[model samples]
Target: MTDKNPFSRRQFLAATSGVMGAAKLYGQGAAGEATPAAKLALQGGPKAVQGGLPQLVRWGQPERERMNALIDQTNLFYWKGPQTTLLIDRFRQTCPLEHVMTCSSGTAALHIAVAAAGIEPGDEVITSPISDIGTVIGVIYQQAVPVFADLGRNTYNLDPEDVARRITPKTKAIIAVHLAGNPCDMHALKTLADQHNLVLIEDCAQAWGAKFRDKPIGTVGHIGCFSLQAAKHVTSGEGGVVASNDPRFGPLLQRFGDKGMDRLAKGGLFEVFATNYRMSEPQAGFAAAQLTRVEGIAEKRSRLGNLLNDKIASTPGIEPHQVHPDDRSTYWFLMFRVRPESFKCERAEFVKALVAEGVPASAGYIPVPLYGNPVFQKHGFFAGRWPLKEQGLTTMDYAQVACPEAEAILKTGVRVTIHEGMGEAYVLSLATAVRKVATHYAH
Candidate 1:
């Protein structure tokens, strides 16, 4: 018997608990599966590695030391300090964008971008489902609908063809997120966006410093957003930037966050309605210091990723995401594809096994299905709106929008961190652990 009051609190609690329990089950592995704790028991509980492979946490000492030194040199109020200004100048010089506006977080930058595009209530913005929930919320916060398209099987980026299918007269824009710092097929996406006259926003939050063909990533779309969260390629603890060559969009972004005036001189104190999303100077200072070493950092991360890929690819049933011939990947995580057929145990179980072997592994970043996350599925500012409520809306409504490939990828991918500070030795150890686990769990 189906409960008629599906949205009732008790029903909702039970339903949500079930989903979270399932996710945890997959995350921790099923009963009797070789969990990390089990492996630790077998291996005598986390001893020092004498041979086979080095440890997995060695990629940031030198860089961090240098960054700290620079921070110490700066005054407390050095928010828009010299180093921060210099980094902005460097990006502008390289990308030749008309303007760039920094913000407190990537999500904030996304909000600014959405507002700049004039994404009114009920307007639809098409994006990939294989991304963080922030991507979806950014649209919803603007009172716009998040229309998800599937990702290409190979690139894990928004499939241009699916994007075309989802676009309706109500579609105001499309956000193309380059998954894992691998550049999306911008040429194809651009072609589609132009034909429809829709705004093309690049969610380059992961693909900072990545390149498509010869052109840098953020330069291709109408506007580009980069994240500087701790785990990202470049970080100032938590900060973001919105960039665009479009003269109109750039200033609009600044105004969206800065009390709606774009500058202190624009109007009376506390002028237009705005959120305080501005990036602070210390974060800017840290980011500026890191910017000086970005190329070196990106290069090191690429090298470690390549090293792991080379070793792991030799073993059967494991594949890495394909980097297109023209794409220069600044891989944020060392992701290896685990073919379900190749393993005796489930992918989640395999992850626990890897962790047991002293590797810090995870299920990568499985984007919450645009309609699946709690924010969209239940009450939030977005759902409270008259138009959205009138639509009998939930994230489930978005589930009907197609994107099978993205859904599958989100369900089955595992990733390990390969920071810029890691060396070949650490990578080889990771490769050895993955191989050992796969062998033990061979189907």
Candidate 2:
């Protein structure tokens, strides 16, 4: 939270002062006529976001110093390793989990969590159809079925009711992905899990400082998985952490992440099989430094994304990304939708206009839901064959899996960049860019 900002005094002023003036000017023109700000930059008019955006400085001297300290360590192993210890401690300040294991990547963290949760062959893990493949990689690896569930229409997260419907006797766990750093409806999901006696794993890779109803995301579920990928809120170049308060799974995290070795018992006998997914001390130290910036970055991004949502709330064809007012979404990115019949232009044209106006916007998020991928469609998870299906242990068929709402969301969604480097005025201008394009093309 006390991380240093890289913006110089003048750069700060340039981002703040100039954009503030632009927002004030956006309201009117001579004799209250439609201002030039209302004109689309696509029409050769003035761009809303002038001077572009200030550069973001993700790491600096603090990260450097941590790496320097890391080099002095005699061994780089994560077991009782100092850097890993500090990294976990810093992470605990925010998440407060009793048992944590740092691993090579978010994918590894998820696999470790799944194995620790005892998700075995033929078991089903219900999760949203609109997330990174890493979210389900572990389930597939464990020879479990990843049952695709429909998402909340607005939240881009798993709809608890839909998840409930998809649950079967074979259901072993529910993986709630906090998509776009927005927390899922954990209360309802947790209730369902309890009623069904299933494990709940929170995929928190995208949610660094996100909170659901004021509770940190990872604390609610049985196991929490986080990413430290280069693009995430924090980074150790590439790494992850899996943790839990549930004693059933907590003590097993280390074993699962470290080739099924029980370090506590000095790893003599192997009851389960696992792969090597350890993190080096250098990465742990770097991540520990990155943790310091989490709060500051999350708070700033939250403010900017919320500002953009508010400014564009009334745009006729645009539906602002939905985030609960009580939840802190940190908004890794804002995803809103455009109702096709409400506008005079196609989604591609609309996106072009916004980008021309200097809004960092794109036509949609993912091209298709995760289930629609070639591998899923063809049932080729492992070397052009799925052993689970071949053995008939599960009668699952991915080609028939349908999550229409997720499909619709991806079709209509527009992804807008929102980061901590951005100032309020820049976000306000982004709002103006959306309004200008939507209003000009209003049918």
Candidate 3:
């Protein structure tokens, strides 16, 4: 052995072989030594991370240029405006759907989808229980019953089996929300929808660059809805886009968003009754600029999120969020669940420990399922009574709805926000913090 090389090739091979042999001592340790218990940060141990993670800037020169150009042109209307056309073209380029229409907000986009699906009074639309109210607002406004379905314990997306069981003769559509940018099992959902002859709508509000088995999420369903709210991956202050490939529904989306007037048609006759949900030129300009940065933003976040998951996969008492191997999740938030049996502490205590260890974490998602909300339970929309149920057209009752899995997940889950600018080292430190806290509390 020389001072520079440190060891000969034969010596190096022998040492590595011995290390492999030590790994065979299962339950003892990875290298033939008893593992020491991790010290809790709450008990005066050093924190894993020393400082805050990087902050993401929502606007920059690109957004400024787009807004400036729009202002110079002085065209604020979306109809036949340059900004609107550019936004639609850019959205199609990214999403690659046959037809796309920009709207005022995510709720408006969903309402357009509901109208295009031909949802009428008393119709039933099935969707995940753990989602924003925007997902079901359109269904209620259309006088359709929003049937809440249970979610997968690991993925937090809609469970296809539960959705299948919830399907009834009155079921007209299924809205699959890509919760936290994790793609739902599109294939299974599509199969169920086809068998029932129901329309499948993909709510991709949280999933800008997510893919399901190599296919973009929104394209897998009949109509796809997206959001451009300030908090989403792409922002235009507040806006949305609806896309579709089905010939029957594609044209209808455009008309529904423009107050039932076919702007492309030679003459306007008001063919369908609808409200104006147009996206203004300024919103389109900003959204178009933001859209250009989505690919890079999603790629970086996915890499960091995956690295964090890999680091914590072997941590005792910690269960990382389950994602399909073939799918690409754009990880809006990195989530994990605690195996309560393996830990002495509850979820609240576990999260408190993590935060003390310099990791950004929250207790869980929404406090309750959507059906448990006061509006649904009291049938309070449109003067305090559900007209369909009152008229005997539907017997759906929100108070009777149950989603035990979603409730349980809400009780045990924890999440950390993932941002495009978060570096790999920061993510790894987050993982270290999680493992330290979890191991310290392990029973």
Largest lDDT belongs to which candidate?
2
| Residues 134-221 of candidate 2: C-alpha lDDT, one tens digit per residue | 9999999999999999987778899888999999999999999999998998999999999999999999999999888778879999
| Candidates' C-alpha lDDT | 0.67, 0.85, 0.82
TM-score of each: 0.78, 0.92, 0.91
Candidate 2 regions with alpha-carbon error over 4 angstroms? 1-37
**lDDT-based ranking, best first?**
2, 3, 1
Of candidates 2 and 1, the better by TM-score: 2
lDDT of 1: 0.67
In model 3, the Cα lDDT at residue 94 comes to: 74
State the lDDT of candidate 3 residue by residue for 302-332, as single tens digits. Answer: 7776667656654555556766666767888
User: 239-342, model 1: which lDDT tens digit per residue?
Assistant: 98888878768768777866576463644454446687877666776676666566665566656665565455435556555555445667787566676876
Winner by TM-score: 2
Candidate 1 least-lDDT 10 residues? 1-10
RMSD (CA, Å), candidate 1 to true, equals 11.5
Off by over 4 Å in 3: 1-38
